[model samples]
Target: MDMQSGTVEEALDKAAAVGVTAVVQVGCDLERSRWAAEVAGRHENVHATVALHPNEAPRIRREEGPGALDAALDEIAALAALPQVRGVGETGLDYFRTGADGIEAQTYSFRRHLRIAKEVGKALVIHDRDAHQDVLRVLREEGAPGTVVFHCFSGDAAMAEECAAAGYYMSFAGNVTFKSAQPLRDALAVAPLDLLLVETDAPFLTPAPYRGRPNAPYLIPVTLRAMAAVKGVDEDELATAVAANTARAFGCPPPR
Candidate 1:
């Protein structure tokens, strides 16, 4: 969850109650990025990612078109400077509906995030929504160095292979628990254990049994259950793998 949207106290309260250690608080704008860092400073178990979402990029300019990339790039770069912010993004393409921003702007924005992530040696928290090939293209073209995480990954097995081949990670969210998530399950089965991460993507994509509710970090267990079943592994093993993968990718230390 983005720390600014879901306050540190709220997430911490939830985590302590749920018995889960470490919460990666995400940041999407200058102010929120700063807030996330502040939250991370207070909780040893919390980490942060600084990003300016592609949609929000347009808000940087009154014009809702392409060309917001440059401003967004600069914003993300500034946010990257924060010490408590460990990664760069939640930035990527989203072409889900009509009358949205063009792919060119999205591509331009994605490349900028890749550049910053590479420069800082911070993981890239990519948000790919309906535009997989373009997202893959930008990463491949830029030769991203730091860990690349496909946040809330929705692609299937073959797509997972492409990501795995590129040394990227596939992070499954609550959506993986849906009965219609067979493709997601298949993708999870083949993704290398060490490259498999899990998240709730809170406030959206709540896993089954908890669907239609305000999502939260504690619901991460729902993802583990589905993944464990798909990989034919025990819940505990799956949980351990997810924890390790997340820690390894974000440079957040494993739970003690």
Candidate 2:
């Protein structure tokens, strides 16, 4: 299934309990990244990523540092080289959250990931919040390589069009299930089905009815059903297509 996008080990373990053949783990910093890598290496069903989210940008910028970014980069590089490491991100811009060294620092971190993902030839999981315009600009400017999945795609019709045209895979989260998300539903209807993906973004963005509860891969069906409904297709067909798209994008093929 998918990794727990959290800092604690207990959460990651809980995510593994989801009824999936395997689970991927996302790591936000150096020590945790290393620990994630170790866990993935040891567990047959676990994989991980070494990423520094845009929200974490302030820590790097605010710290009186001579080697903050460099150190993070070095550790991420080491993680990337690990045989079990399968992706390069969870990185991108976040204009929604306000804080010190916000956009500028997010831009810096995003640019760095673009370069690193290109260098490593691995898939990327992008996170853009109210920064779709800038995120597309930097991705194009830097000439990002490999597959790019825009996780938690909150974009409306037009932004979905832009992302679809760019060949970026769009991953809809449980938020797409809200009754008020008709705009997103319409966009999904128009977007090419093969380019679409679904995620729970656990343990967050739990689908409606399950909202306010900690999310997990087991909750993915809500988003999937909503997406299938958007495309006016049966759930199984949509799942089959998205499975192919996800495997292609992330290099994690479903079991035979």
Query: Residue 17, candidate 2: how far off, in angstroms?
Result: 9.0
Segments in model 2 whose C-alpha atoms lie over 4 Å from true places: 1-19, 64-66
Lowest summed lDDT across 10 adjacent residues in model 2 is found at 1-10
lDDT on C-alpha atoms for all candidate structures: 0.78, 0.76
User: Lowest summed-lDDT stretch of 10 residues in model 1?
Assistant: 97-106
- lDDT of residue 243 for candidate 2: 74
What global local distance difference test value does model 1 have?
A: 0.78
- Residues 77-161, candidate 1: write the lDDT tens digits: 8778676678997888877741354555556667888889888889999888888887887777788766999888989899999
Regions of model 1 farther than 4 Å from truth = 2-7, 62-72, 97-101
Residues 15-128 of candidate 2: C-alpha lDDT, one tens digit per residue: 445434455666666666777788889876566777887777667757746268767876787687787777776789887784544777778778888787777788777888
Model 1 clashing residue pairs (backbone): none
Reference-based TM-score of each model: 0.90, 0.88
